[model samples]
Target: MYSGIGDHGERAAFLDARALIGCRHRLLLDSTHPRVLTGVSEDAGVQQRREAAAAHRMLVRDTLVAADPERWLVIAPEQTAAQRAAETMAAMEAGIERIWGGLLPQELDTGRRGGCEILRRDPDRGGYVPIIVVNHKVTDPRQPDPADFHPLTTELYTWNPKPDKHVRNRPQPRDQQRLAHLYRMLQRHGYASPALVGGAIGYHFDRVLLHDLGPILDDYDRRYADRIAVVRGELPTVPSKVPECRQCPWWSRAPEEGGQSCEQWLVGRRDISLVAPGSRAEVLRRHGVETIDDLAAWEGDDPDDWQYEPFTEAIVTARAWATGAPLVRRVDRVQVTRADVEVDVDLESYQEHGAYLWGTLLDGVYRGFVTWDPLPTRDEGRSFAEFWSWLMEIRAQAAADGKTFAAYCYSRTAEDKWLYESARRFAGMPGIPTEREIQRFVDSPQWVDMFQAVSEQFICPNGKGLKKIAPVAGFSWRDPEAGGEASMSWYRLAVAYEGGEPDLSQRTRILEYNEDDVLATQVLRDWMTDRADAEVPAISDFGRRSIAE
Candidate 1:
């Protein structure tokens, strides 16, 4: 019956179940169709309840008739003193034969064969009919005692409060009225009683209803003893109030003070002042000079007489005053500056093979030795010898001046391979510098200091290799877009060489390209040093501010 009204797919199995039981039955369906069930009735609530009762009655009558056809007349409803009649049914014999009934396909499977056979067969003639009821509704937890045999009803009721009348408009009054009505109905008919009454009551009536209802329900328990039981759903708990209610909007309106609102009180508040260039504000903003800005301003070239403790004291005092909400300390600012220096530089390139020198040239000085090897061999390459000689001369000049000789190549592969191979070839050479000495020469302290100072002063947008330090020193260069006409990669040069002959023209082209690279590097280096000198004050100021922060 459930399958017939619930889903169309189970219709076949439902019919088979009915056939197996050898009895006709009517499906008592719940009419959820709103239009037919709910019409223009003034008391629609009461009418709906009646429909539910009618449906239950029809289902009970049908199930009792199906249990035993011969006993149907004996159990049929008879006329009573009242206008409406009530029905009474006789129980059918059971021990004759038990017939199992279930949705088919599943009940007819091999595992269920025995149960299906029992459902089809008749019971013993003098036995009581066995009743099997299947309900899919969620069971109410607060129900009658499991040991009781009487039927019970569990219902969910809702009530909405109104404003005018506190007594009648509240949830308790309505709930009590509903409960009283149900109790009377149960008393009129000796059928069964409710084991429990449980549901969420409105919050407004909680205090009033709980005080009265909790005791009333408990009294029902005491009176009924084992006959019936009554239980009510638990009320929800409320949270505690926070102590920081002064900052909460729910407490009150805005304050009279002319400042930020309560919501903005947590945000930071500070005052800033703009003064002269060498004033307290400006000096405190220097890169290295933290606290006292003009620590070395009055000392000039003499490093002595510049007490560092006074500057430290000034900084500590200023910070304390600022933290106290109103700043107080102030000082006289003095400006000290450095002069710009220009250094001359030149780029030189050479080509050599084995022990014999081939070609050499200096940037802007075209008239120089340009030797070459007519016979080209892997072991007798002119480029290698020339590179070795050039490196030795550059290192000697760098050592005398206490400066580092930096080489800037176009790409990582080219520069890395040249450095590695040159070091390997000169490992045992008579005039070559050892690996450690060469590394020390490259890592000069003066160069490191200069580079670090300049890098912190400005931004480098087109930074790459040795050119990254250029923009920071206020110098700029024109670097060709990568892979463009002026740009060259080792792979491209190698491809050209692989297809060419070992002639003078090819060697000349290679030498010219290498020389051009050296010249560019020299020009960039000179430009960087000059720019760095001119931008020293700005760089120093930036450095000091960074330290203070």
Candidate 2:
């Protein structure tokens, strides 16, 4: 059988024995194995167990080799195979221990570096063989105490019965006799004995034999039984005035004797007000305030207010003092309106491979755009330098007009930053605008009108995100269809490329996709403006308010 041991040295020995002499029959021992102490202390003890298991495995192989040079043995260290060996050994050890306690001797050194002895005979000769003693060092040396082991049998049964009740309730004479006979047999055999005598007879026997038996076994006299004891008591009975009796804890108290009137004795105690606000005597007060009638009559919001209302602790305490309970108040709902604006942006590459992205603001009544590309090529001559100067002039004009520069996604802006930084470092040129200036340009209030218009009209059911709601807002694209036609977005196109045939070049496809997106944004803005005019009356109201304010 395959045995998993932590002792690598012992494992090597086992392998050597199998290789040198063909000994197929083997008794795999993993006495101080790490697996045996699963969930044990993680310090030195666990490490020690692992090392010991490995060492023992190798030692077994060596012992086998020394005992029989001609015998051949094979040991597999695979997890599943090793686990099977461990399980078999565990079951056998459990059976032996349960029946015969300390009769089996345990290994002296149970730590990681400890050794264990294994006995096995040769298959061909069938005679006494040399015992294999294997030692494997622990990787970690600390071990835990035995008391930490979790118990197996608790909360097994309920409703233990008394002996007198058991005798009175047994419907069948034969069953009662059988139980008595079993009890007598248990008295003869020791309770620790694994002979199955106590389990065979007694109340358990009745449960096995009779399917209809209710709490007879559970209610039987448990004190005299050899097994665990149980407690049994009668179920409580309800009185005629059930509701009143259920609420009264003293319902089980003894009744007062006649002639000596209980009325006299209960007079001062009858009105023992348990409802006092704060005192030891509060629980004994019994002022009549059961229904809401008493509460409404009392002054202040405390008595009239509902106790379950959600209020501040201070409010609750004040209410309780004033009226002895919580007070409820009406809650108002706050309305918030949200809006979004999608701006069409263009990115122009002045140098062959260098580019700068820009944003075009589309307000309901105005169309203003900003361009900010700088010349990266030093050899491009005066035309490129002039173009760069013109772009910077346009940016200054936009800033003067209160317009903000914004990117479709922050990652796009980050890419621009990286490119700018690299050019400054490699080409010995100054970095474009500082990040603070870029942020200021992106967050200007000049685009507020456009933002409000788009937010109220173009945004989907949810407030944020454009990936899922882009098309729904009338921004159409040529997304690929099932068979293999060109689609609008990269997502749909990628799916088509994967599932169907792809004929277009990657660079061309990307350029086309980006252009389509830019155009869609332009169209979507126009459509959203039209929709606001036709559908949302609140848009005009908001605009008028903004102008007036």
* CA lDDT, candidate 1, residue 14: 19
Candidate 1 wrong stretches, greater than 4 Å: 1-382, 394-417, 425-434, 444-457, 465-496, 502-513, 532-549
User: What tens digits encode model 2's per-residue C-alpha lDDT throughout 1-549?
Assistant: 122233443331111111111111111111112243344343332344345445544654554456554433232334353454454234333332111001111111221110112222212332211122223111111233444322111111211121121221223433332333332222232212221111111221121111122233343333122111110111221122112222222233322224212223222232221112212112211234322223223343332233432212222223222332211111121111212433444332321223322323334222212112122333322222333344456556656777643323212443344334333323423324444443464465322232333443321212223332345445655534210112222322332423564334532454444455455555545444444334322212221111113
TM-score winner among the candidates? 1
Model 1, span 388-495: residue lDDT tens = 466557656766877544433333343333344444555665545455654554454322223233233322212234444333323344333211122222212332
Model 2 alpha-carbon drift over 4 Å, by segment: 1-343, 346-393, 397-431, 446-459, 462-464, 467-470, 481-504, 536-549
Error of model 2, residue 4, in angstroms = 16
Per-residue lDDT of 451 in model 1:
29
Error of 2 at 455 (Å): 5.1
Question: lDDT (CA) for every model shown?
Answer: 0.29, 0.29
